[model samples]
Target: MAAKTWASATRDGGQSITTTSVWSVVRRLIGYECFETDPEYLLLQSIYEDLRLYFNFFQPVLKLIAKEHMDKKVIKRYDGRAIGDHDTAAPPYQQVMAFKDVPFETKARLTNLYVQLNPAHLRTTIDAKVAKLWKISW
Candidate 1:
């Protein structure tokens, strides 16, 4: 399992950060960037378990989905600002989920497809569907 870490900068010229610290920073960032009343977060939170189970074995696929469906400009800004500021690693989906614009139906589809697909055929199905929509082959 990946450890949740917070991203931070050291004021006193300290050593580099660990994974845990990076997660802490990201959580704090999201606290401000995302809202408590946001329905997207609530929806994603509700299905987090299903997402984790299904995507756990297909992180690359999820990344591909993010690349295709997520807002590139916003993600670019995030990477340049918040992500660049972090000294430790952060999972791609954490940043991807920050986009509340992604429809709930898409999330549902991604999660449902993962649950229904067999492992051996998972990538092909996902790739084909995503490629058809995004016009890019994996």
Candidate 2:
């Protein structure tokens, strides 16, 4: 018999299920920059995966610069109208830190990492790696 996967073994009626939103964003981020060519693609899947890791490493830095709107609360009016109360636009890192359930140690670690990142350096590295990948594909 095949091994039962977590999704198949769960009984929560898909309430605990996750979506592909993260990957969809990643694909959109890299689609135009990395995969817009009509020529042959990367020779191996591992190469593409490795390149993705490089992109992921610097993604948080980009997010720090581009603040996103986050809905913190919802209010229902007497007239049955609903309104969303959003937190001031903030980076994903800041939003994560605000969550009550996140451990203090985790927050401290993330803060340490965030402070050390150099966006200019990361961008240069990403551009260099992408150019190398393009050279390989051609």
Per-candidate TM-scores read: 0.23, 0.45
lDDT of 1 at 134: 31
Model 2 root mean square deviation, Cα atoms: 11.4
- After TM-score superposition, what is the CA distance of residue 121 in candidate 2 from its true location, in Å? 1.6
| Top TM-score prediction, candidate number | 2
Q: What tens digits encode model 1's per-residue C-alpha lDDT throughout 1-138?
A: 233233456545443322332344334322333222334333323333333443553443222212222655534233334334443433444334556887888767656754664645644544444334233211
Task: List, residue by residue over 99-120, the lDDT tens digit for candidate 2.
Answer: 9999999899888877777667
The deviation in Å at residue 37 for candidate 1 is 55
lDDT of 1 at 31: 32
Tell me the lDDT of candidate 2. 0.47
